[model samples]
Target: MLVVFDLLYREYCRARLAEMQKLLLLAGESAKPSKEGHGAADQSHDEKDSLQQRGWHAAD
Candidate 1:
């Protein structure tokens, strides 16, 4: 039981960390202004990254 909980908790923490990293990356990007309409595209790429990367929680 303890092992199970530990595994689940680890997974949860990894997911949350991945989610936070995605948020930080996106926030870092949005903090910048660009003449090109690439923000959406870049955000989409970040969204897709979580999907492709394991132990990641993708934001809706």
Candidate 2:
């Protein structure tokens, strides 16, 4: 019984570790800066367009 419980606990820990590693990898990838020269400008333009389409107006 003890051995079975220990094995299950280890498996659970391994699964949790794998999930954390995946999350870290995704976070690292997202934190990387874009390689394209105009990426930021393009993203900003798209965001502004989306907001305007949703009836969001800039404050004067």
Candidate 3:
């Protein structure tokens, strides 16, 4: 049950991130900084590290 809940939460987060990205793009008329690393706070540290390498630094 716990594992299933985690999976569902991640999926929900991903979907919300997608929506936010679309909104930002439409508002700016251009791509936002990080196309793939939406919702970095909810993502794993390793994923965030990769994003950092790509020039993203999470808020401290």
Q: Which candidate is the best by TM-score?
A: 2
lDDT of 3 by residue, 1-60 (tens): 999999999999999999999998798876445557556564677686788877744444
Across 1-60, the per-residue lDDT of candidate 1 in tens digits comes to: 999999999999999999999999999999987878777889899788876775444432
For model 3 the TM-score comes to 0.48
The count of backbone overlaps in candidate 2 is: 0
Residue 47 of candidate 2: its Cα lDDT? 93
* Candidate achieving higher TM-score, 1 or 3: 1
Clash statistics: count for each candidate = 0, 0, 0
Give the per-residue Cα lDDT of candidate 3 at 5. Answer: 100
- Model 2 segments beyond 4 Å from truth? 38-60
lDDT: which is higher, 2 or 3?
A: 2
Q: How does model 2 score by TM-score?
A: 0.58
Winning model by lDDT: 2
Worst 10 residues of 3 by lDDT: 31-40
Q: lDDT at 28 for candidate 2?
A: 100
Best first by lDDT, ranked:
2, 1, 3
| Ten-residue region with minimum lDDT total, candidate 2 | 51-60
